[model samples]
Target: MELEKKKIVEHNDLIMSSAKMDTVPLKFFELAVSEIDTFNPPKDNTIYLSKRDMFKFLNAKDNDNDKYHRFKQAISKMQKQAFFEIREEKGKGFVFRNIVPIPYVEWKSYSDEVKIRFDVEIMPYLTELKTNFTQFALTDIQGLNSKHSIIIYKWLNMNYNQFEYYKKNGNRDGQQLYNLCNPIIEVDELRWLTNTQKEYVGRFTNFEIYVIKKPIKEINKYTRFNVSYDKIREGRKITKIQFHISLKGEKTIENSSSKPKKVVTLADAQQSPYSQLLIGAFLLQISDVQDEKLMLSLAAKIYPKYDEFVEKYSLDILKKHLEYVKAHSTNIKDLVTYLDNALENYQKRLVGQEKDNKESKPKNRKKGVIQKEKIPDYISNPGKNKLTQKGIEDSKAADELLAKINGDLK
Candidate 1:
């Protein structure tokens, strides 16, 4: 089936922006602790490692049934509890958190991929903030048990500037490192939440610096893409500011000059026909420069209108990819039409050969009758000689009668 190409247009008023936070979530931060009692008693507590003699470890030889049985009890225990939750705040967007038992062995494993799969399945509904927390907190899990504090500290330092570095590289590996450690089952690390941090007024345990992004105008700084729109309220006029932003994810913001920010729209950027032609070029730059998966995520944020922004580039790229596949095919057999023609030709050839064989073979006949194939001629002509002799006698008698009558008359 063929799908029609969709057209995408950018409005003059709309602008694009992206942003990311540097601080790790409190839940994850609490998880990173040295309390050994939270996990199963390890024979050697000095080094962080999974229990070597684990009753069941997934291996290549295990069948699906065996594997399912091994984890069945633990998985069942988790279903009863609400492992994840999403709640709303009045001004702020939302909150998502996971509350589950975390097995110690699972957390100690080095595989980041396994950790993330567990996280997504168990804690399915995190708000945008919680989502960011899951992504950022993955690396901190190791900090809990590692002996080298400096190395862990250094890693966090490097992580702080990851957004900017990722921007330049246009890759997701760095961002994914943290997300890789999110898990479905709560590990012993999470139990530390109850033990290590004492409750104050039953809320607000430890204070850590969380880097948040607010409007430049709020701080009285000049932002490049800020604009005002007029709204009428009770016959009075009110103006609101809109900003177009791209999150660099850098620890630092570069533009220091404080001017009253002006908002620049795609229409303002491309007022002329020449600039409109360049809009596609501009989109290409943004798509190429940004992380592809994050772009899809951001697309989800501004859906419907963003759908147009996404449909234009995404569909065309998909079409071009499919076209490449079609163009590169080397033979007719690669197509459906060719396969049909080949099958018809094969059937015709078989029928023609059978007809030719029948025409070339000799036919046998006996006793003025065509003999059936595979029967001996003697068997088919049984008593045929006796019948011939009787026919001759009859003919002689008739001839004599006719001759005698003719003589008498003369």
Candidate 2:
């Protein structure tokens, strides 16, 4: 049996239609809302509220209120006019079907709004590609009272170009089609490609593509297939390597456990004076020692023989070392000690008047407490009513006027 649609009822001339259906729950809506920009009226699909959210909003003593009943009443009314259908699949959560009666509008037409979310496992691909999201206003919509199904479908179609671009560039970009024809694709693991990317690529028949990473130095390793000439392109290899460096973090490497680790010893490191300078520079960059004295102390620990090296080098080389240290790392413990002593001596030079001014900092006042007028008159006038004659008269007049106004208005 078809679920009945309700008719729009007249309530203060407002066309109100809504539905009550089991949803994915408030947790899903909370997660989605924080990430998605909500739809305004006329350009929006049916508003989805999780069953949990509805319960909270209604504030029923024990979830026994007729709040959901009111929603069903509205949807039924709207359905009678063929505006839309509030539907729930047997196992799937609630879905408000777009039933807006517009000519040239086919329900089976393609959707443009492809929303895909990923778990943390897919963060590498999502971050690398740098996806762009564009939103459009459904200006084609007529009225907020009218069904916005057509507007929503239009919205879906409008946003689909991005996935289409991903489709055309599938082969070169490592996008492939799945066996199932549905616009969604799931893989055990996908790097440099989103689940959404999989959806676009997985719509093919026999074509399959895979991602291959190569070092920048090894660009000519693979062969390319030419479509027009049916031969490889002259001097151009298919397996070209592209190097990508990330400031956020390293790119994901599959089979990480199998890779060999490279370790260097302190003696091996000390063999290269340049390497020592690099290490010192790196340490200075990483350290949180703000005091120059602390930095000099750290430098002393890092290079106990720095002073001895200075005696062996020429004046020019010594200057170069200082320059390299300054350029590479700012380990400035010695500088901080000098600055601190200088600041203390400077402060000692201040006059008594200056010290008094420095000590006498202004106090921030509380809003009402510091105001003279706001302090209650009870403290000053113990005998008086504290309420002035004007106040009593005003109160009496307001009471009398309110009674007269209520009588007249009614």
Best by TM-score: 1
Give one digit per residue, the lDDT tens place, for model 1 in 277-392: 21222221222212334333323332233234235335433222223333333543322243234334533553565565566654552222121122222112355633345435
Give every collision pair in model 1: 17-245, 18-247, 101-186, 102-186, 102-187, 118-183, 118-184, 119-183, 119-184, 226-263
Q: Where is model 2 poorest over a 10-residue stretch in terms of lDDT?
A: 222-231
* Candidate 2 residue lDDT tens string, 1-410: 10011111111101111211112121122222223322222122222324443333324345576755653443344334323222334565644343322111111115322132322221221122223332222221111111222221222222233334454666422222111111121122221121123333542221122222111111112111100101111122221121111111333122343231222232222333432332332322312232334444434343334434445433333333433334433445554344334324433433343455556644663321111122122112336647566545644654564444334323
Segments in model 2 whose C-alpha atoms lie over 4 Å from true places: 1-209, 212-273, 276-410
lDDT of each: 0.27, 0.28
> How many angstroms is residue 60 displaced in model 1 relative to the true structure, after the best TM-score fit?
29
Listed in order, each prediction's TM-score against the native is 0.18, 0.15
Candidate 1, lDDT over the whole model? 0.27
